[model samples]
Target: MNRAVRIGVQIQPQHADYKQIRQAVADAEETGVDIIFNWDHFFPLSGDADGKHFECWTMLGAWAEATSRVEIGALVSCNSYRNPDLLADMARTVDHISGGRLILGIGGGWFQRDYDEYGYEFGTPGTRLADLAQALPRIRARWEKLNPQPLRDIPILIGGGGEKKTLRLVAEHANIWHSFSDAATLARKSAILADHCADVGTDPAHIERSTGVRALQGSSPDDVVGDVLDAGATMFTIGVSGPSYDLGPVREWVAWRDEYNARQG
Candidate 1:
């Protein structure tokens, strides 16, 4: 497959009514974003920590009904929150509802607040990765056993940069790998991921590379786009939030995406 760069917008789900969120999704698709995402957390990860927030899969279920075309999923769902089989079932249901536009973005999880409040274990990182390693196959197996089955083979997006274990799990399971580091760091990790793929006999090209870009950090979308493309990332996401869901940065990204594609062509 050609490694054409794409843009994603994570409508940060904080301090906004569902009505505003719904409109934001519509605006994003209209602006030509390739993917739309929301973080999976019970509470705000940023401003006003106790601000109004929504559940992940449930909001995705709603997104299935609200949006007609754009791919939608969690930025990185906490794998420890729900059982693997149950999560697979939820992904399947959303896939069917969206006519196969769902991506199962998940991770071993790091937020202690969610684990503590939800009664899940706030175990060591290695233990959480171990659980994730076990959960991946079970999720895939359940997808095969489900009655209606998924509308399609759902893509799995794993987020983390752990070289030894996390990247190894990604090599074994992920269809997409999301990381939260700079371009140089991502380049190094991509090489590490390639080594893991070699060890496991899986082609490194089978996994899409995704990374989050912060627009206000004095980096233009085009600048980030160039760095990410050079670093082997195909999917670049910008996270935005508001009581209004300001789309200024998203529009800039969409414009950059068009230019990038045109240049490639």
Candidate 2:
């Protein structure tokens, strides 16, 4: 599918109170972001390590009821945190609440602190990836068996750059592939992803390429964003957090989204 360039914002649910976080979501939607994301981690990923932090899926459920336009989800929920079937039901429920605008961005568990504090096993990367590989199919099967079903086919987003396994999962299952990859890396891995798609009998062009704005490298005329676009990224996201959730970057990227889409037209 030929998708228009889109802008997303990850409203990091850390170092801020819920009321403040709620307002940030409102601000992002009003600024015209295409998607809103929050990550799945038990505690703060930056700043004060013990700062105020909220849970992921619960916040996403609230976002479904709160926002009227922007698509909402986790930047990447840890697959080990919840059972695949339960997670699928939770996603279906949120999809209904959002009127079918949920993107189920998930990945193998990371950040050992979340695992240790939460009393879950902080398994090795290999174990975590294996578990994630097992979870994806079960998630889909459960999605099919749910009452009322998802309002739409929930788009799956796999976030990771592991060549041997993560990219293979993306090729086989994902509708979107997000990574913190630079243009050269994206170009190379996208090719690898294509090879995986070929092996899995999936279409290489069907997966929409995504990246974080800060992950992009280069200081060109377009700050190398154009290079990432050329390499296949259509969805670009920047993260905002805390005391005052700034929307200036969000607004700037929204404008960039519009310009890129218009140019495409």
Candidate 3:
């Protein structure tokens, strides 16, 4: 059977207080979102560049206990930020805490600001992608040796649309592929992914298609939902930022989610 569509909201990790962030997670789960995500960044990605921000994995660890039912993960954790082996253990711990509700969303490091301030090498994109390529295997190997493996296999979500190297790595390693491209770009890239999968003798269908749908002005909740799913995006993730964490948009999307699921039935 074809996999059913689901909605996700990336409570943007910028300009929000913990109280509001926590509330957003609770509300999203209550509203029946399938997943909740936060980005990995040192500073705000939106709003004021120097505005309030929070760390990714720590927030996810908290989200694990604060909400039940909805899966939680980083939109894509930067590989350069932590030791890959350590990252595996961290993910395993969160996976157990969340009762196997963690999706290990990760990617080649971007965001030079994060690297510059944190003392990580702000290498060229090529160098960073190389590091990511090397880390994937190390992370997997450590997971095997770690005392208690992840509560489940803990799905690996790789986000990037790079054709030559990144998607090749996705074909080999990721359980989910997330990219920011529009529908046409997604269709094109997915075909490239299929070819990569074929080259590796792997079944492409095993990797889920995940895409980001940045909320647009004046767009109604129903319109966003309809357009994204119709675009062949099964997993839709909307981003929200704040001092308010105004889940006004999330609430609307959640209502639409209920309707979408009912229609599927």
Most accurate candidate by lDDT: 2
lDDT of 3 at 190: 84
* Full-model lDDT for every candidate: 0.89, 0.91, 0.85
lDDT of 1: 0.89
Candidate 3 lDDT tens digits, 1-265: 3567778998887887889888888877887889999999999976689998899999999999998799999999999999999999999999999999999999988898988899999888789899999999999999999988887888999999999999999999998999887767877888899999999987888888888875667797666545445545678788877766666666676677677677888
- Tens digits of per-residue lDDT, candidate 1, 127-183, equal 999999999999999999999999888999999999999999989989999988777
What TM-score goes with each of the models?
Answer: 0.96, 0.96, 0.94
lDDT of 2 by residue, 93-112 (tens): 99999999999999997899
Better of 1 and 2 by lDDT: 2
In candidate 1, position 92 carries an lDDT of: 96
Record all residue pairs in model 1 with backbone atoms less than 3 Å apart, i.e. clashing.
none
Clash number by candidate, in order:
0, 0, 1
Off by over 4 Å in 1: 217-219
